[model samples]
Target: MRITRRKRLLIGLVAGFFLVFVTGLRAFDPGFVTSIRLLGFDGYQRLWPRTEADYPVRIVDIDEKSLAKFGQWPWRRDRLGELTTALAGMGAASIAYDVIFAEPDRLSPHRYLPELTREGATGTELPDALAKSLPDTDEVFARAIAGAPVVLGYAVLSGDGGSTPALKAGTAFAGSDPTDALPAFASTLTSLPVLEAAAAGNGAVSLSARDTEGIVRRVPMLFTDGTRVYPSLAMEALRVAQGASGFIVRTSDASGEIGVGPPKVTDIKVGDFPFPTTERGEFWVYFNADRADRYVSAADVLDPQKRAAIAPLIEGRIILVGTSSVGLYDIRATPLGELVPGVSIHAQALEQILSGDFLSRPDWADGAEIIATFLLGLAVIGLVLAFGAIWAAAIGGILAAILYGGAIHFFRNQGLLLDPIYPTAVNLFVVYAAATALLYFLTEREKRFVRAAFGQYLAPEMVKRLEASPDGLKLGGEMRDMTILFMDVRGFTPISEQLTPTDLVAFLNALLSPLSEEIQQREGTIDKYIGDSIMAFWNAPMDVADHARLACRTALDMVRTVDRLNEADAFRFRARGLATQTVRIGVGLNTGEACVGNMGSDRRFNYSVIGDAVNVAARIESSCKAVGADCVVSEDTARAAADFAFLEAGAIPLKGKTTPIKLFALVGDADHAATEAFKTLADAHARLVDAIDANDVARALAGLASCRALAPAALHDFYDRFAERIDAMAVAAPA
Candidate 1:
């Protein structure tokens, strides 16, 4: 139970070794752990989502309403041209189409009306201007696009591409080339040549994230096909709207404080606005809930009446034109748990760019979390070894709450992503493992202590008891009748702290010398000494006359011996300039059948007794501190030693037990048993227990008061604590 400095350090090192192993496993970053970290980030968004603001950004949704009014998929380029013109007329800063125009419009007059002209004899000849205008619909669309700051979107195929996207903006790197950081795509499906040439800029609409579930959490700000790097749809929109010529991509520095990392993109700037990004050149999106105010139907932009009414939402806003129709299958999931149009992702990204309020994880984030996990693990292990499992767990729970809550707060207030789940999880596992390891170590040390204490055969019977069984060298032992006694000094910690090592050793020897003499005289064998406590058993090696009675006599004598030392000032504490203090102890005795002989690890063995009865003795001794008694014995021991002066304590529940055990305090020898005062006090104690069993709080309290008055001064604290327990029960009971 007590470890020296060297042993404690060894324990810490063992736990630290375990910590390093677990941290290595985490460094592997398995999929499940990644999912857990992502899930945690998602929860933060759900709890404190971005607040909606009227930014200069909007999504021109080709929703079900628009589709119903405009017929079906792939409306003629003339209609798209008309929609483009309407947005431009409404003062849209930049209109980026999330749709594609890969082929020429089939409805152009030369392709269809030429047949009508040949077959329909009854139809009049087309007017010259109308015929010319019908054949040049693509030209009309191209002209509309050329008039506005329009950005054309293209599909980025994952496999080999037929053709790379035409670059619209020049890119310049600030440090070592970080081309690898930009997501690379195989090919692209660009707009029609004429439409693409007319647009102010062309960008890839494709978005990729850390998750495969298509949850748009982080979207790349830039992309590349082996030869050239291109801006994403959102970035292109910002550049075109701001009339910026080229972009600057900054990687980590090669000198000074920001140096020392592998070359990765640190920030990207478009015009005057710059923002941080993940090493992969991706921007983290802090999303708001689906807002009706953020979307304007394509039909509304086309409808003269609706367009007049909704012009405010379109004016001066960078609009992303994309289909929100479910049948189109362009819907994607968001961290806010909503199925949104693909264009909504771009819109939110653009919004954050404009507001300069981006969610970012620093390069040092991983290192910070690893250190945090290790430090917390160390603290938890120390607490478990020094205190106990319950106290450590309580403190761990509080620390974990603070960490998780702080993570949420930082995300909400500072747009910072800090993970708490992994560290807390690591700490939880560390605490459990440390406790189990320490328990095993304690058992092994006790075995070694037992071996050293009884290296020589103290008695011939002890040698016979240890060697008589064939399995003596083995740990499995034989059962025999025994009487177990456990004794502990109550205030040993504080008392030991006050004395020097030499003085403390001398004091302990002086205190234990007389107690050991009484036990030996009574034919009790001392099993071991754990710190200031003693464990001894009777009838283990050989049977003695009334072994239970002898054990009880030894316990009573030990109590009186401590009392004598305190009264005589035996240790001379006052001479050291310290206030006079009495040394207190608690003793427990139990008689039952227990396993006795050489038992422990096969490599090392010890002569000892272990069983439920032995465990009960230890529990009873511990409860003496709670019951305010010097010596307590179980019912079996009381029955074995019927002539001893014993007063009933109670049927109290011990740790890890289903039923309570009956216990009594051993007062004196047979002469004390014959006294009338002992009998009266015993009667009162019995009535108090009966009142308590009957659930009569008032009667129990009154009986307890009477018993306390009749009992000796030593039991007053027990009665006082007993009354408090009864009151607590009454308050907790139903009215």
Candidate 2:
């Protein structure tokens, strides 16, 4: 049993739909992608299209290369002293290190030790000498620290050890806790004198990005260590950068049974002005890790040579000195790269937060993504049903590309966060696969029905169209502003006479399928087949805006499609010992008022057209062989075309016509080469027209010949008809 093309396409479409539905239902992750998009926002803030509406503090990266040049970890105190002094001299606004000088420097343990390690070593001369060298370094570093404004980092332990109640008075609470609150993420300590004496401001650098899947996002703004709430690394930088008097954490009402805290905003008062934030302790980081920006390694500061190039960024900048080396375990996994600099990530976040251009996924985003995907899928499927796989895919791909690219572009340039990947991919995959599959099944079913009913006597496209517009198969008629197209296969009669009936049938089927398909695909109704001639009409059952353009496109495709068929039939033609000349078709199309619908009795109805427009189209097709033209149309048709390019083919009076109709030859101009060639012909034709208007028959003939020569066989057929008209005018000219 042969299956019809319609059924095949329908089956394919259904399968494709199922695939899309499953993937859309199961694979989408709005929260995850949203978080990644936020990170991308940070990148945009720091990188391309920089903004001044961002955090002022700059990152001083200790990159992998710097690590290789300088020795391993923990540089001596004297080196740190030099760095502090350099920053102080440059008049930097403030210098805050993300790293803590938690333990006494190994080089000067006894000198700066918090009395714990110095008790037994005081009597030893070896310890004394080491202490003497190291303690002096500390005093010099301490003086540098003491001279310039500096905010040293320390973490508050949330669960156990943190700033005591005594230290809690001046610090701001991150608002009242919602139910039981969690502890500060990290904690740190230093000797009492070290913490008090050298510090201009004491704050915690302990903060963390919560991860649903161990991917850091949403950095905490304020971390609580039981009684007191402390600032984050970025928060400390802001305070130092702005010289703000203090920080304030604001919270909104809680929701639900758990009473989760509403989004918090951190407000900092700079002088008399307030700087607000999205989260309690956290703001976006603006990353500006330019190669030329301020950067220095702890090892480089230790070395005299490399430190010069790296020292300038530290000058008054809230310099964040942290490890960027892969070996040092300071590298972080960010949306951009796995080996991203940890400090740079913070810097980028800070920059983004301060700009108020955070990568945001509001609660309403998930539904939007799903809706977009669903609609896009539906669109792709509908187009496939209307067109075919190749064209549908092309259109689908273009749409997807535009959407994704536009989203990324908007995010980077306009500071908007939107997900382009999931919607585009999901839509393309689901819609295309589902639609194509259904179409394949429909087409298969159509092929089966056609093979069973027509027994390979009718073309595939005709069968497909029959199935598509079965309503038109009823015995009736309807008036429409239609463009009727007629195609006549050149040399088909002679070729058919030469071949056996079986071979001729095969050849005819091969040539007719694509031609008919082109017409149907362009939304033209296949009126009927008259031996080697095909009659089709556009804007019949369907209203087509550019009916003339569709007619032209259909005609051109029919001519081109024969070549594709000839390639496949080349072997058969060769085996028959024939010349294997390619089968070519001549087409004539006209747009005008026409009567179109099913004709004949109910038992055997035929969908067809009948009107002057239809007659003119048929006459044009008949004239193709005589004029040596492949395709031609009346001026009425050309005027209706908004796009197709054409060459003038002089006026010709039909047998029963009172007024001679002006005609034009259809020329291919879809690509640059064809368009250029056609342009040259058009220019020459214009000159010819000018000569004819002036009754300069000689010049007109000359211009016509030039056009003919320039385009060769391409316009030869059209030129011959013009030449005849020019000759007649020359003979009848007044002497």
Top candidate on TM-score is 1
Report the backbone clash tally of model 1.
0
Which ten contiguous residues of candidate 1 have the minimum total lDDT? 466-475
Give, for candidate 2, the lowest lDDT window spanning 10 residues: 164-173
The local lDDT score (0 to 100) that residue 117 gets in candidate 2 is 49
- Score every model by TM-score: 0.62, 0.49
Report the C-alpha lDDT of model 2 over 1-735, residue by residue, as the tens digit: 223355445544584556467446634655665555455444544455444442455655556665566556666666666766666665567666666676666665554453534465445345555545545555556777777666666655534464332131134434554212333443456323453367555554543545443334445555555445655566656666667655654443323222234544434332333444344444433333333343455555545575566556454456665666677666555433344655665566556555555544333345666666666676676566566678778887888788767766766655455565666765566657666665666556654644454333334555555566433332357677888888888877778878889878777776777677787777777767777788888875545678788788888888777766677764277566776466778898888898866578767755567988888888887777665678888888888874577766667676567887777777763462247666787788889988887889989989988887777666666677677778889889988
lDDT of each: 0.81, 0.61
Q: How well does model 2 score by local distance difference test?
A: 0.61
Stretches off by above 4 angstroms in model 1 are: 1-18, 113-133, 254-257, 430-735
Residue 208 shift from truth in candidate 1, angstroms:
1.6
lDDT of 1 by residue, 365-447 (tens): 77777777777787777776676567778888788888888888878788889889888887687645665577566646645
